[model samples]
Target: MKLRKKVDKVLGTALAIIMGVMVINVLWQVFTRFAMDTPSSFTDELARYLMIWVGVLGAAYISGKRLHVAIDLLPSRLNKKGQTKLKVVINWIIIVFCLAALVIGGLRLVYITFTLKQSSPALQIPLAVVYAIIPISGILMIYYKLSDIINKQL
Candidate 1:
């Protein structure tokens, strides 16, 4: 429980910081394009990358909070024990999906990008770095799912 709280705090702080930077970057982009009559070359790419981080990390954060959208009908219909069993099964499903799709697939993608030395044109930042959030978020989600199972909550 304490670990989960700490992880939540760190992840939340990171996402907030990324969002702030993205907002500032986009604002600068808009100001430069229209107000200054010149666009900032790197701001667009930076914002895009930041958005990827936010979206992926945000998903993990939401999972930790058990705030992911879900139909409550089934669980609501069940008794307390049934609901808990269902939640455990669902958490296991989520863990498996994240492990297979996000962790494995994302790692493949990151490996390919790093191997190829792929980078964004404008930002010149490695795509591997940008794609790192996929596996990171996957790991976080797995942790949350496991925690949910151990705690008998979703």
Candidate 2:
């Protein structure tokens, strides 16, 4: 739990910084395009990439906090043990989905893009680096879920 909290804190700080930079980048783009009549070529692409990182990292942070949207119709009516069981089941489902879809698929995407040497047009950054957030977030989710289960049991 301590380790998880530490990891979450670090990730949250990084995500916050990325989000701040992205917002500033957008503002710069708007300012340069309208006021200066010279649109930034790199800002748009950089902002887009930063947004992707923010979205994925934000999702992981939310998952760690157990703040993801879910229908609580059944859990609300259940007893303590039943609610715990339901939560465990849901966590298991999340783990399986993350493993299958995010971890595996994301890794495959990173590999393919890296091998093909694909790069963003404006930024010229490797697509693989951008896509890496998928697997990274997935792993974070898995770690958080496992920690949640362990903490619950303890």
Candidate 3:
């Protein structure tokens, strides 16, 4: 459990850093464009990539917390047993769909990136490097979901 908690902390710290980077990039771009009369091309691109990282990292964190959106309106109306069963079913579905999509899409992207050696236009960073977050976050999400399913749903 401590390991999982440590991972969560790391993810949280990463999320915070990503957000900070995005904010700083945006502000820096705005300042330069307005006050200094010149805008950096790479700043916006950097911010965009940071934002993508933030989104996927945030998704992994939220998955761990079981905070992703769900339709719970009908659950409250059900009996206790029914509610539990319904919740289990929903969680299972979520886990399956998310994990499956991650595997399929992630593999395809990785292969394409490997073949094409894609890189960002402005930043010159490998596109696959930026996109790697998707699979990593997906793996994290799957781990969290599996733990939750085993401990709570099963």
Candidate 4:
């Protein structure tokens, strides 16, 4: 729990910064587009990339907080022991399928980005840098899932 809290704190701070930067970029883009004669082409692209990072990092925070959505129809009516067992099974399924897919898919995205030497049209920033968030988020999600299993089931 302590460690989870710490991870949340760190990720929360990072999310804040990323969101702030994204907002700033958007604001600048808006200002430049409307108020000034020339708008920055790169600002929009940069904001988009930052938004993806924000989403990925935010997911990690959600996982750490155990705030991910779960259906309550059955578990809410089940006995305590049954509920526990069901919850364990559901969580394991999530850990095995969802997290594993994230890892595999995310890594493939990173690899493709690297292989193509992809870059944003306006910003010229490496797309791989942005795509790297996928696997990193997957790892964080896995860590949080394991922690939840230990705290709740083990």
Candidate 5:
């Protein structure tokens, strides 16, 4: 789990930094609107995009940590062997979902946006850049789940 530790450290630090920036950006937006009597055009958009990254990346981090919320109704009632088998099944289902919905679909979206030359209005950054995290997080999730299964650490 050494690699897991490293990933956790990096992801936690990145999330903290992004959250700080998002807070600052919102504060600046508020300040500019109230004090300067004009809204800062980019802060709102930047915050929005940062939030998207934070949310998705946070999800991936939690998945790696096995901390994401789950009801566990059936697993809770099962014995150890049954629970382990169920967990493996659940993990496989999640892997397939992430592969299809997040990885493939996200890549398609990013490609389309890039091909269309779409850009955010306020930041003027390419839309593809913003959408890129989807597949990245998807890959990270796949890695984590595979590692967990291989190590039998769950």
Candidate 6:
């Protein structure tokens, strides 16, 4: 639980910083484009990359808080015990999906990009680095789900 809290705090702080930088980057891009008559290619690309990171990390943070989207129709109709069992089942499904799709697929993507030495056109940064967030977030989500189950049992 302590580790989960720490991870959430760190990721949240990083997300905030990324969002701030994205805002500033957009403003600067606009200023340079209209006023200076020279659009900043770097800022646009950087903002997009930052946004991607923010989105993935933010999703993981939200997952930790159990705030992600869910269908409540069936649960709403169930009794307390039934609802609890349904929740555990749902959490297991989520864990399995995260492991197979996000973790495994994302790692394959990272490997492919890294092996090819692919780089972004504008930033010239390795594409693998950007793709790395997928597995990282997936792992974080797994951690959060496991923690939730443990906490519920305790």
Candidate closest to the true structure, highest lDDT: 5
Provide the lDDT at 142 for model 4.
81
TM-score of every candidate: 0.97, 0.96, 0.90, 0.92, 0.97, 0.95
lDDT of 3 at 98: 66
Clashes per candidate (backbone, < 3 Å): 0, 0, 0, 0, 0, 0
Residue 104 in model 1: shift from native, Å?
0.7
lDDT of 3: 0.83
Best by TM-score: 5
Residue-wise lDDT of candidate 3 within 22-71, one digit each (tens)?
A: 89899999999999999888998999889889988898898887777877
Give the deviation of candidate 1 from the true structure as CA RMSD.
0.9
lDDT preference between candidates 3 and 5, better one: 5
Q: Give candidate 5's TM-score.
A: 0.97
lDDT of 2 by residue, 1-154 (tens): 7798799899999998998899899999999999999999999899989989999999999999878899989999999989999999999999999998899999999999999999999999899999999999999999999899988941
For each of the candidates, the C-alpha root-mean-square deviation to the true structure, in angstroms, is: 0.9, 1.3, 1.7, 1.6, 0.8, 1.4
> What does the lDDT read for residue 25 in candidate 6?
94
Error of 5 at 134 (Å): 0.1
- Per-residue error for 73 in candidate 4, Å, reads 0.4
> Which of candidates 5 and 6 is the stronger one according to lDDT?
5
Q: Which stretches of candidate 3 lie over 4 Å from their true place?
A: none
How far off is model 2, as Cα RMSD?
1.3
Where model 4 places Cα greater than 4 Å from the true spot, the runs are none
Q: What is the lDDT of residue 96 in candidate 3?
A: 77
